[model samples]
Target: MEDRDWLILKTIYEEKNMSKAAQVLHVSQPALTYRLQQLETEFNTKIVHRSNKGVEFTGQGEYLAKYAVDMLNKLRMTKEIVESMENKVQGTLRLGVSRNFARYNLPPLLSNFLTKYPDIKFHLITGFSSEITDLVYKEEFHIGIIRGNNNWKEQKLLLAQEPVCIVSKSEIDSNSLPALPRIHYETEPSLQSVINNWWEENFTQPPFITMRVDRIDTCKEMVKNGLGYAIVPKACLTEDDILYQINLTTRDQKEILRDTWVIYRNSSLELTMIRAFIDFIKSIKQEGV
Candidate 1:
């Protein structure tokens, strides 16, 4: 059936009368009746039960009406998105981000992005790098900002690779502390394995973990409270007085560390807005920052 048929069905469902539905639609009663007849022919089911007082949907019509509403809503959204993309105008972008990037980096960039695309809306979700990457791979998110190197074979833009440092309270003597309590994160499997291997190679005794966490922000907080010490990307740090980095006389040459990346489906590389954002990220040299 045509779109006009759904509109007629919707109007009839709302107005509950042939004359009123036609009046509201600014169409003749006979035209509305013909449209409904065509839909009923298409579906091979009765859709309306007419009474002297008004009209109501039959069981089949009720079901079709519900589907019509949903289809219409989706159609409108699709039209808006397509038109906006074509016109270089506005649209909604669903984003999946690692929890750390969502907390540390997205604030200013989002602020600027919103200013530029005022009609655009964002749906944001935060999780681990792997979790966000899975969503991107599944096409659940149009774009993703995730921590650690991407191994998904998708194209990615490196956002920032700030210095990764160990943080702890002043009370924890960096030089003399015996088997310091290191905070651990559960998100990055590759990085976690690397950290474990680095710890094993560098020290005869392994540093004990005071606590394990799912998010780096919490790990930072735990370190600040002297609950433990954590190694995290330096972009998470502010020049504020609340947190400090641990001093190390000797560095482990084998440690692997870095920050997050912006990734999208390989097919999306041709989209203008996506390319624009990638260029903006590189122009800022976010990796160097």
Candidate 2:
């Protein structure tokens, strides 16, 4: 019912125990318990079920938790907006990025943003595109830059397009399909299925299978060592000397060209910081850099 009660509920959800939540909130245990009891009495239902180990949210608690999070986010955004009007842009910005972008794309963006706003702190979470998308929807991230897929929401920007490349060692002759290793990235099903379909259409038969890994860096490393031929984004390849590109003509070779996007929810755009960030991205493009 009150902000303090919601805060207590959030803390309990995080800490999972009354004593721990009280300690985290810098309040007496009895006071925290009383507040939670008051909330339960006001709602006429048990919000949380206490146990020896920790607390578990009841059905009512779960429903209220969602409302609490939405309320807290709105409150925080309101505070941030008011503060920004006073010429201060200082708050935490959570970002969700794929493992691919974390390596290839994040450095420059992070460097420039941090240099420009030294006071603003950042928390970067890296996972696959599917995981990042889920996080973005859950409000875990203010914005996410992810690889474009049909399943993603419509609100996204075409940031950059990097072609899919097949790389192998120079020593291997291209006259005949060598019995070399074949490396595949163990990414989300959407992209992985696309890769499989493209590989089948492009190659006469599957090449010798050596490894399947999650990260593009591993694929790149294996390719450099002549472990196998790998299909990956051109962005991952930094060295021009060790690896040789084996251009392929697949049915969806045109579609293999991956376009990166910046995605955010409609509600997130209402926040000044989020809007400024999107505007900054637009400004960067306008500068042609």
What C-alpha lDDT values do all the predictions have?
A: 0.73, 0.75
Pairs clashing within candidate 2: none
Alpha-carbon deviation at 181 in model 1, angstroms: 3.1
Each prediction's Cα RMSD? 10.2, 3.8
> Per the 3 Å backbone cut-off, how many clashing residue pairs does candidate 1 have?
0
Candidate 2 residue runs with Cα over 4 Å from true position: 1-4, 11-42, 50-55, 87-90, 138-140, 151-154, 171-179, 203-207, 252-255
Model 1 clash pairs? none
TM-score of every model? 0.63, 0.78
1-289 per-residue lDDT for model 2 (tens digits): 8877777788888888999999999999999889889889889999999889889999899888778877887776676667666555567777898777788778898788768777777789988788888888877678888874746664677677777667887645544453766887776565566567765665677667778887777777877787778766776677553688754445544446766778888877656567767877887778765
Span of ten consecutive residues with least summed lDDT in model 2 = 246-255
**lDDT tens digits by residue: candidate 1, 26-138:** 99999888888888999999999889999889999999987776677557546645665675735667789887678778988888777766766778999888888987886
Instruction: Report the Cα lDDT for residue 168, model 1.
Output: 78
Model 1, residue 282: what's the lDDT?
A: 78
TM accuracy, model 1: 0.63
